[model samples]
Structure formats: structure tokens, C-alpha cells
Target: MSLCATVPDWQSPDLEVFSFFLKFCWILRMPMPTLQTGLPPGPKGSLIGGNLAQVGARRVDFFLEVARTYGPIASFRIGRWRLFLVSDPELIQQVLVTDARSYIKHFGARTFKPVLGNGLVTSEGDFWLAQRRLLQPAFLKAKVVSYAPIMAELTEAMLAKWPEGQSVDVAFEFSALTSAIALKTLFGLDDHGDRVQIDQSLRLTFELLTRRLDALFQLPLWLPTPANIRLNRAIANVNAVIDSFIAQKKAEPPGNDLLSTMIAAQHEDGGRMSARQLRDEAMTLYLAGHETTALTLTWSWYLLSQNPDAEAKLCEEWKRVLGGRAARAEDLGSLPYTSAVINEAMRLYPPVYVIGREAAADLELGGYRVKKGYTVLMSQWVNHRDPKYFPEPERFLPERWLGGLAGRLPKFAYYPFGGGQRLCIGVHFALMEAAIVLATVGQKFRFTVDPGAIIDIMPQITLPPKYGMPTTLMRR
Candidate 1:
């Protein structure tokens, strides 16, 4: 009954040829359900890499083509792994909302763990739920509203520093501004020296992270490569700053800042997050809180410069609403066009362009049988530009969002902030901060892109202007 007895003897010459054939079959075999039935159709790919070569470089374009060519539910392969790109809004909702429990954060999220640690963005199951519950109160509408003053004030200071007609890199300027705002609002680090150190470390960390994420073949972190060395140093620098902040907070009474609020938070079982947890959470907030907002503002400026009509409308709204004064939290509602411009800009170039997950079990999505362990990709870049939902999809039209058009769209049709229980906790904060900054800056100046600069989209951790957004500021 032994299995070896059922096979040819290893010493036999015939066994050698049989072994080679078996190896060949294994190598060439597609990692999907039997090709005879079930699994959805996809582009044929090479044996070794599958569709990696075809879909790796220009992922957004590739996904859009897949959706356009194969309809909403398109299947592909990356090496031996089966991948699915779901473009249909209803199917996307199932993956992100209705059947969300059936999937977990995919491999893409793991790449963030080296920087974010086991914080809110990376943790799963009970730990993630616990962290979310504990941090919920800090981002409540009332608490977020209190940070509006800080956002508006920081933006006003930033505007004052710019020379009247100077051509500056708006992307870099916004990054610095948002980093300062995040530090103040999240950790209450208003000291000049502390803010400088933290901001520099954050910039380095993000640069390294973006490179690693976008690389076709990322080297292991343990290697002593120059990028890895730099990443280690950047992580250490950020950790040093965070540890200092936590130690300083521990020695003092609780303050109104987000860090202090988190430190003082306790679970029903009376458990508090340890020092390590606190550091992870702080780093997560710092990275997630600032970068997206900055990229949004950066792209907003570029879009406005390209579309002068939209820019004019935004300026008119600011002048009519704020009357050349700094924008306050209350002014957010009055400046509808400014908000619309930001909305449209995000629709055109969402900072977090894609949301990825992995199937935990066999399932059916959009009438296709998706086997277990497949990677599920839902891209905002593709879905946001769907012709069915957004007519004249390529045009930058802000007015389309003016009259509850956004609310009327299918639920997942326009999720710049994502969806489901894991929706970005800083959604309200980001929207408020963007509106305030746009209104405050728009009232004073208009930015025009440099004619000679070629701005390219570097879609890494965020969609940033590859060459930086070089623009001259004109006093309005």
C-alpha cells in the first residue's frame, strides 16, 4: 500500500523522463481552477511571471483596459497567484462592504508594516477592532472641528511666507505645511526644533517607502543596500522623535492633543496601549494624517492651474465668502465651489488610488467563481473614471458635484475616502482641512504652472507630481 511502490523505481531510466514531464506540467500549469469550467477568462500570460510583465508598469492603465476589454470582473495571474480586478460598483461594494469579512488586508498592506508597525492601518481582527474603538472618540465631529483653527492658522502662515510673484514648488510647500499641521493637531508639537526634525524624518521615510512600494522587485529589508540603509536610518529617526514625545507626555498631565487623548484611553477590560503601541499609533497617524492631504492639495493646485476657468470660479467663491479674510471652520459650508473643485480634483487623481485585499475563501463575485487565496484589487483610479458613472470622464468639471450629484451616484462609484467599516477615520478632518486651506490660500493668490515644466504622475504611495509642481503665485 506504500505510495512509493505504485511508482516507477528511482534507479530506472524511464523514471528520469517521467520526472521531467511532471516538473514541466507543474511549471506550466495555470494556478486557477481547472480551465475546463468555473474561473473567469483573462489574458494569457507567460509561464514564469504570468501577467506581471503586462500589468506591472502601468497598473492604472492596465486595470482600465482589463475592465474595458473583459467587462467589470477581470481575472489575471501574477506568477502563480490568481488576481481579480473588480470594477463594477456593486461588486466592489461586496468586496469592501457586504462580504468584507471574507477577506483580509492583502500583501500591499504588509509593505507598510515596516513603517506603520502594527498600527490601525496594518493590524487585523480583534486588535484592529480594539484600536478603532479606542481611537473613535478622538476623531468625533466635535473634536475634529476644534482642529480647524489650527489648520486655517497654519495655512495662513504658509501663504504669508511665499513671495508675491515667485515660482515655487507647490508640492513641496504643501508637504511642509501639512506636516506642520499634522504635528500640531495630532501630537501638539509646536516647538520649532521638534517640528523640523520630525518633518525631515517623515519626508525621508515617505520617499523610501514610495520607492520600495513602486519597485518591481523590492529587496529584503535586512539587506545592506543603500535604499535599505537609508530606510532604516529614517525609521530610527522617526522612532526617536516619537519616543521622545511619548516620554514627555507620560511625565506630564494629559493634554487636549490626539496623542494625550490616546495615552489616556482605556479598554473595557481596563487595558491601555503600551508604549510600543502608542508609538506605532502615533507614527501611523503622522504618516496617514498628513501625506494624503498634502497630495490632494498639490494635485488640486495643478488641476486648477491647468483649468483657468475652474480657478477663476474658485477665487470668486473665496472672495464672495471670506472677503479676503482667513477662512474659518464656519466658512466651509459657504464656499461650495471651492469644495467642488477639491472634490473634482480628487476624482481626477485620488491620492490613495487603489484599495487591495485578499480572498480568504472561495466566493462568487459578479457571477464569476473566484477561488480562495486570490488577490482582489479595487482601484479608485479606474472606477472613478468609469464612463457609465461619470460622463465625459476625462474632463475636469467641478460643477457636476454641485447639486447632490455625488450622493446620487452609486455608493462605491465615488469613494475618494474608501468605504466600509475601515473607511478612513480622518475623512472629516481631511475634507475640513482641505477646504480651509484652499479657501484661505485662494483668497490671497492664484498659482499658475510653469510652462516649461513637465509634470508627470508618480503613482506610488500617493499620486504626486513626479517633477514637483512648479508654479508662480499671483496676488489675486
Candidate 2:
């Protein structure tokens, strides 16, 4: 049986007792050696909850404040959990690249297992290595470039429905567009009925997952809480959609889509992925593949609307490169400004803003002795906005990326897609998709932020516009 099949039952009597004991220990402020010695300085927390309340209330701000207040490395406690936040680029490289083998996906990533299963994001060690190797070919540059037409076509179709000079939620629109593109590219599912059903299921699953992240204490999966029930149903719905696609693929001959490729993938031992494994990988790709790209586009539109000069530059570039036609794969190289706009937008609002990992062994990091079982956090949100690396870091300056300026920055200082071996597999796919979609849509329309609408960031599975970005689309 797979580890994912064993969802921890938190309501068990022994587990409840353990939880209570931990809470009791936290309340007494027990001076464990790990907590007392050689740890970086951070804000002292309450006896019981530590800094969790503050973090839960405003995750991004809390992280930024800690980094700002405590220098590059900071330490805090939540119950018995010791978390170390690393803000220095070199330390980040150590955790993600140089000494990466000493870490594993953090407990926070386990929150995704109910939905993502033991997929790439949550899996570890040999299994994760095998799965990554098996699925890598699907995301190769050649294969990803082939999907550009599908991305452009889908964006163009979505843009066709927009009424000129009318307010629309660009966030929602981009979500739908990207979801459609993800479906087509991954499964060749062009049927409108299937797309709608799958999109709703995936969205509901993510929504529930987001709520789970916000909850301070999690109930066991078997508990009959309303949220738990909804989450289970959403997971079921998503699994049904994925299983259906897998069944169809199994029945038919292989095609070039990711599903077909995955169906035909084999391990070095000449073994194929189990059905459950395939389901997990497919769901992982489906969720990660679209949500981040969609959020990037959403934030891009929001940022471009705020920065008219950037928008104008992007428009001019599209006109020069695309000539009033939909962007193709080949044109991505020529549309540096378009790429830069996406890059800057992601830097400002990274989709996966907070990345977490757990130390596999007691280790030294950032000149501090971080003990085993400690959670190590790295925030692109904080790093990307550091004025040390980026002058006027808060500003949306796409032009900064021109003339090899990005290459000059310190490694891990500007990782919108993260870094190292665990770096996003679909980086090329996402960049191509974003460029094509931006060019295709920008050639025909421009959006202005709707007045009196507050767009805030909701850092969940992805950083999404909290209130949904309301904007008016103007035909060009």
C-alpha cells in the first residue's frame, strides 16, 4: 500500500493525547536544547501557540517582518515545531541546491497529499526521483513548445467573449483560460462538457485545500466536519475526472499529449506507473500546471494596468513581433518585453510565494545549527522584493530585465519558479504559455483596473488576487 493511502487519523486517542502533551509543553516554554542554543533571533511568541496566530493572520507580512527584523536567518516556534526562515540567497542555494539532499518536503506539503496524493510535490527520496525521471520527458522544451498553439488558441477564444469597455474579473477569466489550455495540453480533452466539469472539480478541490491551509488545527479525514466532507467530495470529483481520462487513454493508442506520454512511460526497471501513481502525477500536473500560470497572467494584467509605461512597452513589442496576429511558439524569443513583463509580475507576486522544507538531519544553515525535524522556509515574496537585489524592488519595472540584467542578479535572488532539482518541471511550458497568451490577448485588448476595487493577495496553494481583479477590457 502507498503512503498516501494512509491519511493520518488525527482524532485517535493516542494522537489527541500527543497533541495535548505538545501543547502543554509549549505553554510551559520548555527549554529544549534545540530551542535554547545557537538558534537565530526572532520575535518571542505566546506560551501555547507561539507565532502561529500571527503567521496565520498574515502569512506573507509575518514572514517579511521576521526577515526584516531578524536579518537573513530567523527562528520561531509554533507548538513544538521549530521553523527557520532563510532569506539570504546563498543560504537558500544551500538548502535548495548545495546541500539539498539533507532536506525533504516539509509537513506543510503533506496538506496537499489528500488531493495531490504522493505526487512529485509531496513525495520524497527514491519514489520522487523515479517519478520525476519518468515524467520529465513530457515537459521537455520540444514537447512543451508544441503546446503553444493550444495555449494561444484558448486565450484567443476567451478574449473573444469579452465585451469592450465592460468590467470583468480578469482573474476568473484567466483561470478559466489557463484551465482549458491545461486540459487540452495534458489530456487532449477538447470537449467543452468535460472541460467544464473537470475545471469545477479541480477548482473546488483547490478551494478546499486553501481553507485547510488557513485552519490552525486540522481534523482527521474521517471526521464528519463540513469542510472535511466538502474536501472529500471535491477530491472524489477530481479523481473521477482523472480516472476517466486515464481509462480512455488506456483503451486507445498513445497520442502526443502528456496523458498519452505518461501512459507509455516506463521506469528504468521496465515497469510502468501504477494507475494510482498516474492519477497522482496527472492531478499534480493539472493543478500546478494551470493555477500558477493563470495567477501569473492575472497579476501581470493587474501590474500592467497599474504601470501604463510597462503596458505600453509590452503592446509595442507585441505589435512589432506579432503584427496583430496571435503569438506562436517561434515568436517567444523575439518578444523579450512580453517575457519581461511576465517575469516582473511573477517577481512581485510569486504564485508559490512560501516554499517549505524539513531538515532530514541536524545541520548547519546560515551560520546557525538547525536541528533535525525543523521546518525551513524560503519566501520568494520577501527575496524578490529586497532592495539589495532589485533597486526600487516594489516597482513594476519590466525594463530591468532587459540587457542581461537578470543574469547579473545573485543566484536564488529572483526565483519565481523556485530553484534546484525541485524547480518547477513546467518552467519552459509556463513561460511559453504565458508569452503566447499575453501576446495573443494583448494584440486585441487592453485592461484597465476597475476603480474602487481592492485587489489583495491570498497566499494559498498559489498566490491569487484575494478579491478577484476586476478590470475593464478595452478593444485595441
Candidate 3:
């Protein structure tokens, strides 16, 4: 038993949290490394480190285009903010894996900023390490298995509701489906008022975070513009809901859900999370747990819909193995084809397509001179499509993953979950959930994209379908 044990199961009273936060405020720290100057060749920027030009619409995509022109190692500036774009796999491996402690996360991850409030996703110092260690036990293999029944239940429920022979947007469905699964698995709640409020707040706050990429850190958050207003409202709603949930949880007996585990977590140092830390961690789980998996599933459905042959192969596998019964998470190991299919889909349309890192200190990389104060980016969208690794990269070929192709690909060449010490903490959990959900949904219905449906890439925080992936679901 630790501080987490002594703290109330639900929200801590306001004053306790307020007092801790007030004492903690005004303490700023940046554990930055020194920059090695005269780095790689890249585009030039105006005063303020190219800040003016970089703060426009299409920020992520536009930066990707620059990576294309400037080659593997490119540097640019946005109002004195040195942005480094690296495409070479070796250099990326070095930055993320070989010398991991040298770099920190890039300047983007702000959506989690307000909600998670320096939880695992944002913490960089000892706090992050400590929290990560305490939380690791809950996501282990055995613990992940506990989540499967919830995954199966939710997927089947949605499947039951899907009207056959009518086209529905798979992307929208995934958004809802994954969010539902996240809520159920993490908080042990189904569709309820409090649960719905939490989900609604997440969408409102994070949706704004993705759309308002151009206005980060520039203006006050309380501004009345559509983006600011919606964002603030969403944050308030989310914070309030979390606060109440914490209070309620504290007054009750403990359970086995993620929220409970976090509440019960304690450190060897005899420290425990404050109520605010709990809220932020919960928010982090909510945000990171759902979005990317939804995008990957949507694209997988879209791709299979386009390739009838692939769909037929998948059907053949399902018919043979499932024999008209629903598949379970444990069945994933037996469903080799499904995993291959997912791998191929991720290659073509990776979730969180690009990774961003900041230069702690300037150092030479990939034969290019670099400077400090630069943002370094590695694009999964680029490397996954590279001809050297994936021949005919545009083609949707699941066989490649089944054969020796995946094994032959360079270590860093296929990093959908990112790499280094900052690799996604939920990688194993996400993989299992996605596989189970895919098998269940794919085996039950034959879905295809609605003809003439626009497939614009809304490359927001995640590369999702802009127009939404419309598909007709038919019973097998």
C-alpha cells in the first residue's frame, strides 16, 4: 500500500489537488543537450527560425514534402525553431535506438498536454520513468489477455447493429468502435452517461488539437474562436468528469480495470500519484488507446474492399478456420493471414505516419552536419513505402508479410509503433485488440467501399480518412 492506496478511489477533493499543483507551479525545466552546428543541407528560413511559414495549414504534410526535397537529412527554421527532417533509416535508428537518451519528443503532442497533464506521454524526467515502471505490470501478456473478452463483446455488439447490404462509413464506425472498446477495457464501463461524457470530451479536445495544428503555443487558450471555444469546453467537460470519477472510485472497493490498477499503483520510493496525475494518465490512456488503431482498421477495411482477391483470400481463411463462428483474441496466433493483412495495410497507410524528435545537441548524422535547436522527424509514411524495402509499394500485397520480406526488411524500416525508449507503451495491447477486432468484424461481414466515395487523407494527428471510408456490410 502506498499514496495511491491512501488516496480516494474516485476524484480527490479539489483542495488537495489544487494545493499540490500550486506548490508545483512556476518550476520550469528543460533537460536539453548541446547542438553540433553546420548540419545537413536543407531549405532556408526567414527570421524567427522560419516560425511564420511553418505555422500554416497542412503543417505535417507540408513538412513531409520538404523531407522529400531535402533528402534524408534536412534542416529548416520556424521563428528560430530549428526543425530537422531525417528520412534515412540508419540515421533514424541511431537517433531513436542507438543514442536514445540524446533526444526528446518533438513540439507537437499538445492534445495530451492538457488532459494527461504530464502523464506518461508528456513526462520526460524521473516522474515519467517512475510512472512507466509502475504501470508496466498492468499491460503485461497475462493482463492483456484479460482485455480480450471485452474486445470480443464490443466488436460483436457493433457487428450486430451493422445493417447488411447497406453502405456505412467504416472509418466512422472504427472511431466509435475503438472508443467504445477503450472505455470498456480501461475503465470497466460500457455505454453510460459518465462514460459517454468522457468519450465526448476526448473527441472535442483532441479533434481540436489535430485541426488547430497551425495555432499551437501562439495564443491564449481561452480565446473565443471556434477552435479555442470548442477545445476549452471539451477540456472543462473532461476535467470535470475525471474529477468526479476519481472521487467516486476512491469511495468504492477496488477492481481489476486499468483505472483501478493505476489508482492502486505505488512506487518503491514510497511515492504515489496525485489526483491530477491520475487524471492525466487516464486521459493519456483514452487518447492514445483509440485513435491510431481506429485509423489502421479503417484503412485495412478500405484496402480489402478495393482488392476483391485479397478479400476473397481473407474470406477463405475465415471460412476454413472460424467455420461461421466468431473469432477470439487467442485465435490471432492461428490467424497468420490476418496479421499479414494488417502488416501490409500499415505499410501503405501507417498510423501516426511521421515521428518527431528534438535535437538535444547538434551532432553529425548520415554524413550531414547538423545544428542544435532543430526538430528531427522520421516518416514511417516515407520509409514504409521506400522501393528498396517494399517493391511496388502502392500494391496491397499481404503475402509480403507472410514470406521472408518482413524479416528481410531493415530493423527501422518497418516501425509502425515507433522505436527507441519512446516506443508506444501500448504496442502489444493495441496489436492484440486490433487483430481480434479485425478478425471478428471481417469474418462476420463482407464489406466494400461505397463506389465513388471520396478517400481524402485527413492527415491530422493520425492519418485518417478525411471523407470517411464508406463501405457496405453484407453477411457472409
User: Model 1 misses residue 41 by how many Å?
Assistant: 2.9
Off by over 4 Å in 3: 1-37, 44-64, 110-112, 193-200, 223-226, 244-248
Error of 1 at 150 (Å): 1.4
Order the numbered candidates by lDDT, best leading: 2, 1, 3
> Which of 2 and 3 is the better model by TM-score?
2
lDDT (Cα, tens digit) per residue for candidate 3, span 1-476: 77787766445577577656655653444333344556566666665536445535555566666767777777766554666777778889998988667677667664447656887877885778887877777678888888888888889999889999998878778878888888777766565566567765766666677655544345567678776787888889988877776666666688778888888887676667787889888877776788788888988888898899988888888788877667776678888888888888888889888887776777667876445555777888878867778889779999888876767877888999998777888887888888888888888787867788888786666787767788888887
- Candidate 1 global CA lDDT score: 0.84
Q: What local distance difference test score does each model get?
A: 0.84, 0.86, 0.76
Off by over 4 Å in 2: 1-36
Give per-model TM-scores: 0.89, 0.90, 0.85
lDDT for each residue of candidate 1 in 155-256, tens digit (9 for 90 to 100)? 988888999888999998888888888878888776356656776776677778866765557899999999999999988888998788788877877788
Give candidate 1 misplaced runs (Cα > 4 Å): 1-33, 191-219
Residues 158-232 of candidate 2 have per-residue lDDT tens digits of 877889989998888888888788878888776356656777776677778866765657789889999889889
Clashes of each: 0, 0, 31
